[model samples]
Target: MDVLLAAAAEVIALQNVAMIALGLVIGIVIGAIPGLNVPLAVAIALPITFKLAPIAGIAMLVGIYKGGTYGGSISAVLINVPGTPAAAATAMDGSQLTRQGHAGKALRMSLYASIIGELVSDIVLIMLAVPIARFALKFGPVENFALGVFSLTLIAVLSEGNMLKGLSAGVLGVFLSTFGLDPLTGDARLAFGSQELSAGWSFIALVIGIFAVSEALSMVERRGAGPIERSRVRLSDAAHRLSREDWRHAAPAIARAAPIGVFIGAVPGLGSAISAYLNYGIARALSRRPERFGKGAIEGVAAAEAGNNSVTASTFIPMLTLGIPGDVITAIMLGAFMVHGLVPGPQLFRDNAPFVAAFFVLMLVTTALHLVIGRIGLGLFIQAVRVPNQVLYPVVLALSFTGVYVATNNLFDVGVMLGFGVLGYAMNKFGFPVAPLLIGFILGPIVEVGLRQSLIIARGDLTVFVRHPISAVFLVLGVVALVWAGAREWRGGAARGASAR
Candidate 1:
């Protein structure tokens, strides 16, 4: 309690509050832009943090981390582009809502859900860090491999009405993920003799190409010898506000997904993207009207946003408690911790309890700042969709190339971005869901590393995964989820056939 009071007092300073607000706004803007994500934004701002006092610097980063996670949904909903990879699942329903003239409501729900998740995860991080980190530490290679496989299976099946296509896309993504050098052996597998390929495709380039560049190309195709109307119309603030029904649906989804996000986040390597997709699948499966999903369902947006944002603070659990980096963002924050002469792990908690408490207070304060900044700046973000395609597409193209180039400083990445953009457009033309491909890409390496390591530990015995009780449970759950999805799809198909007859 003394520590809590000290931390609370620490955050009440005018300088700290100003820095938090600044970071929140900057993070949101950076996140709202395609090709720019939270980690990159935080990295860019890390140097600036060095000039400030330790607590203030950490507070700003916390604010950015919280805000950027939510900011990605702005572009995902309004432009069919995800500012961050985690927001990709949000695009499925969020973009549909934009087309249907509910951008305001979609944006509103995203902000609210993000705050709810962030707040919950922040509290959890403070209260349960030690126990959760201990539990997470128990996940060895076998358990991770099983969890990744199970997540992939669930995501693929939830890919909306066509399991075959979804699985195919997922396979392709996994195949693509194997293009770089093998994780175990440094030997290149499918680099096709190009040295550049050895490093693997740049994630930012792929994301920008797949979403931003592809959207721009589609806009060009839609140009009918004249300027096309704005895809998103300007709606009033009141129009954008969530209805009571929206809250009712979104509330439960946010609640369910928050804990899932926190759990996945506490365990290192899962990341926000997987959390978003996994929670989305769970939300759909749990919904009474599962058919409403992927068609601009409020629950989908809520789940995806909540899932991603819930990772914001909980991701620090493993990092702070065990000195393990939970994700790339926390990995960066780890540097900030060390720079301030503060080391993570059990010793730091005992040695710098006040500072740790201050960190916790900063996280909660950042959540509140994120809420205010998001609300104030939402209309400004929605205005981007109101710009005509002729004007907007060119800006998007420029921004996409610039952001990618700025991040990597390599022209080759620009080419990769363009190539993937074309691939994304082609996939869209073929009626394939892009989400599964992303899921496969993200989970593929994890699955590969875990399975291989587990096998190695067991001297190539296949039963190694089943030998561990946790791994065995996850594998069983994967099979059960697959069966449930198949059965549900079969029943739905039969019902549709009967109705048509």
Candidate 2:
């Protein structure tokens, strides 16, 4: 109890609070912009956070996670464009609500749902992470290796529409991860003889490149596009407020979807975007007035927002407890934690309880801050939604370049950013998803280290992966996941072919 209070006191400091608030505002702006996202914003801010205290820096990032998740809905509601991919499902009902002159209600409901989802997920994280970490502590290198492989298999599941493409990206990511010095041997495998390549590519540069720069380049393609017309919104009267009927509909949807989001978030690879779609679909299936769904059902917005926002804190479960990042944003956070000499895993709880407590406190505070900031800044964000691509794209491009240069003080990193950006752009053009590549890059070292250590311990017997029951289960699960996704993809293709006939 003393430790908890001390941690709380540490996090409540003015500097930390101010950082959190600033992050919320920045996240909202970035999320409201169509070409930017929370991951990109967090990546851009990574270099900036290097100078701050750990709690303050992490609090700021947490604020972005909370606010950005909600911010996406602003553009989704006010305009037809989903500022973030997670907001895509929200657009179905959000845009419809706007068309029906209920933009204010949709936006407000989105805010409320997001807050509720985040709070619930935070509670779950606090309750479950420590216990899960305790259990994971028993895992040996073999088990950890299997877990890493299982996580890689999830890339296929994450691909959803394109399993092969996802796997290919994952493989490429793993290959790129091998660029640095070999762990078992000092020999450089893929450094291409460049001295800097010996250290491998910077994660920050890759993040900015694949997400920020690539997105900016895509935005360039739509340079001539005009700002979307503002939706008519009523905010002054009781009519615009959430009515009893609205609450009645939304409460159940939020209840149902928040858990779905939590489940997806606690796992690896599956992200808020998938949760939002799943929750939206579930809500539609359960709704008595299903026909009103895409035409502007309040429940639809509630479910999608709740689901998307639920991922905010729950993604921390795997990251904090197991050292496995659940998504790209958490992957960046993983980097942040490591940079601060705060390694996450079972030992973190035992060694850094105070910091962990403070981090958790920050998570809860961020939710409240999100509500306050989101309400006060919603109008400004709505207006930002109307900013032209021509204007916004250049600013984002410059920021991406500057953020990378500022972080590394090396133009080489900036060049790497631009190169990865082009690579990302080409990948997107050719129907590849960037998430797998990022995940694979982040997890590659973990997988390699675990596997090599396990092999060494087992005297080079590969069967060690199967001898341990936990490891065996993971290996089996990975195979099953691959087969299931492959079968589904094949069936989907066959069905499409049949339809084409």
Report the alpha-carbon TM-score of model 1 versus the true structure. Answer: 0.94
lDDT of 1 by residue, 97-185 (tens): 87676788888888888999999999999999999999999898899999999988866466657778878888988888888799998
Residue pairs clashing in model 2 are none
For model 2, how does the per-residue alpha-carbon lDDT over 145-197 read when each residue is reduced to its tens digit?
78678767756654655677878998998888889689778888788888888
By how many angstroms RMSD does model 1 differ from the true structure? 2.3
Among these predictions, the greatest TM-score belongs to 1
lDDT of each: 0.86, 0.79
Name the candidate that leads on lDDT. 1
Candidate 2 deviation (Cα RMSD): 7.9
For candidate 1, the per-residue lDDT at 424 reads: 91
Candidate 1 at residue 436, lDDT? 78
Per-model TM-score on C-alpha atoms: 0.94, 0.62
Q: Candidate 1: minimum summed lDDT over ten consecutive residues — where?
A: 224-233
Clashing pairs in 1: 104-240
